[model samples]
Target chain A: MISKFTYGEAELVTQLQHRNNQAFTYLYDNYSKALYGVISQIVPDRESADDILQEVFINIWRKIETYDISKGRLFTWMLNIARNAAIDKIRSKSYRNELKNQALPDDVSMLGDQFVKSKADETGLKKVLGKLKKEQRELIELSYFQGFTQEEISKGLNIPLGTVKTRMRSALLQLRSMIEQ
Target chain B: MNIKEYISSGIVQSYVMGLASKEEQAEFEQLCLEYPELVAARNIFELSLEKRAFEDTPHPPAFLKEQFINYINQNTTTNQSKVIQMEPAIPLAQSGSGLRWLAVASVIFLLVSSWLAYRFYNETITLKAELQHTKEAQANLGTRLKILEDYEKMVINPNVAVVNLTPMPEKSPASANIYWDSTTSNVYLIIKNMPKLPSDKQYQLWALIDGKPKDLGLFDIKDDHKVMLKMTDTRKAEAFAITVEKRGNTSGPDMDQLQMMGKTQL
Candidate 1:
């Protein structure tokens, strides 16, 4: 199903390329929390996630010219860059120095609660996810949430890599069919 | 593998997991070009996975989003100012320096005009050649400055991790920083104070894990003092070391000949 805030990806990206602040704000409204969730997973710290959020957008602004529609969706492309950027920030020496041997802070704990609350309010997507089989849901979750590679997922789940792939494919196929329906 | 078999075999998930072997990755990239539906499947799966992951977590702070937009605006303006202000100044300096040299040559001509026609003419030719050479050097300098700026930008990337490798006590007094992008899963070695290697040999980077060496990459130091080089597929590195290897690297590292090593804590 189409998201409620319906503008063509190309049109929105075009406006973004022209430095249209409203277009950017709209994009941020739609994707920021989600992107933040992804960033927090990789960085796992509130302050660093906050910093990486800024850096991700700055990079998105600078590299908007390189976005090729033929390659992938704008969301995926931006997500790729944002996720990569967040991962980089944590791996950077400066971040390591500041956060040396420190466990994730308390604020990060509240992210789980906040996400659940927001997700309940945004129930349409939640329902769609709820429709998936537990195994499929678990596969998707471990891969995305934990940032595990397929091999890691296979080993973690005690499934052969081949079976993991087949299960993931069927799971995704089902989700797509359900969403489109 | 045929396209159908490849799809059925779970290569798509392997692609999604980014765990596809090199040959598999190459084949999948080609399939992505040939099959639009395959591409769409990848996108849909990626989105489905992404959406689920996002919904599973909390909304980022509203302030963080606001901060991001504000940062973008500030950065754009700053970068704009840099481009607008810095671009012309270099050329202006080069031309200004050239003109100053011309002025100096004119004063020299005035001083030596009465000495001899042949000397005067030869000196004039030499000055003209020197001026051309200076202009060429200035142009090269500008290009080098731009490359250095690019390197600075690369470091600014949030995903690039910088590890400073200090010199070893037993070997040459040289040090370097390794910028590892765990996102791209690559590493870049930026050496400092390294003396020139002999003509036939090069420095090889090794990732030391639990007292074993994994070859990262090899490089030869340039005469221009170029010390920075980007390495590839740099995953699972605990500590980094450098060694004098043969012109091409070997499958295993020679521990006895290690030049420098540094443990990465931060």
Candidate 2:
């Protein structure tokens, strides 16, 4: 629900099918911050992140008919869209051209240093994830924030795929327990 | 498959992060279909991940949402498009709310300008029509002035003889004048003091030549201030007279209906 306007998720989906502006406004108000978080975490650059955020919603509009209520919630579908767009932005020629100017290092500290600037809210997550280890945090960050495949992440971290899966399971279970609390 | 075992496999987390392999995804989807508990776990994982993402929420720059709405509307109206680049995509989000206010002000300015343009166009057309009407009236007044000037010149001519017509004894207020130029044989009649006539009646002029009544023409009693109209042309006429007649015509003047009579001076 939005501040100036509001609608339930189910009714809002029906109105979104009709392509109403106020419904879209409500959608933006309710979910834009989380969606922006998803974009900025992956793209890691201000300009490209903004561009991808715009493209993400446009894709949502063009492909809203493809969304199945039975398959997932609206935020889930939109999260997928934002993550996809951010990944695509990182994969784009212009994004690579911009990155070519920077020194691309291959270590956790380098990536962490760059990503930490956008992690103002991540400090808050540290409190929620306080009991968890650094390895579990990095596992969740690479798989979720970086949108890396398990195999790709295993290769990147020079670890086995089975180890990657076990760490991912442990980290998310920790998060699940915290959420329950 | 045991739903607890499936939930523990971390496959749901992989699916939520969009990192699951195709085969793993397909199998997990089938399991979710068979078990509502798997769906619940998947939903829980999605919410937890969403909560995790809530950490990096950076206001997303206000313009990002504005650009997104514009892009959506543009693409929805058209199935396919080239591309639209909203400018200054970087850090402009910090001031994006100010930019939105500027956009709203621009739209208001455009609407007001269009309304003013339409009003000015209408006024221009109306003024042109009024100017044309005034021009036609001026031409009409100019023609009338020319005729009056010609009348004044003719009246002062040395060769012109002025004849005052006497009214009938029964109708003493009914009178007329004859301006006869003997040298040019241009005899004109001017009815001066005749009362209003019925619509079906008109006053007819007559030339009294050698005691015989000759029909000249009809004349209107109103508009007596203007120049006289030339009656029937004659080299020598003894007298001129006018009589009430039917609107169309009569071969001879009615002596009983005579309104005025005047003799030409020697």
lDDT of each: 0.69, 0.73
lDDT per residue, candidate 1, A1-181, as tens digits?
A: 2235656778998988887776777877777776776677666667877777776876677678788776557877777777668756755666767776653222322222222333333343345656788778666545544345668667755779899878887876665667644
**lDDT string, candidate 2, A33-53, tens digits:** 878777766766788777777
TM-score of the A chain in model 1: 0.61
- Model 2 misplacement above 4 A: A91-93, A101-118, A121-131, B51-56, B75-266
Off by over 4 Å in 1: A1-5, A97-99, A102-181, B16-26, B75-266
Question: Judged by DockQ, which candidate is best?
Answer: 2
- Compute the lDDT for candidate 2: 0.73
Clashing pairs in 1: A88-B158, A88-B159, A89-B158, A115-B58
Write down the TM-score of every candidate: 0.42, 0.53
- Candidate 1 docking class: incorrect
* Real interface contacts reproduced by model 2, as a fraction: 0.53
* Tens digits of lDDT, candidate 1, B45-107: 666656664565566677867786786666566655574455455556645688866786899
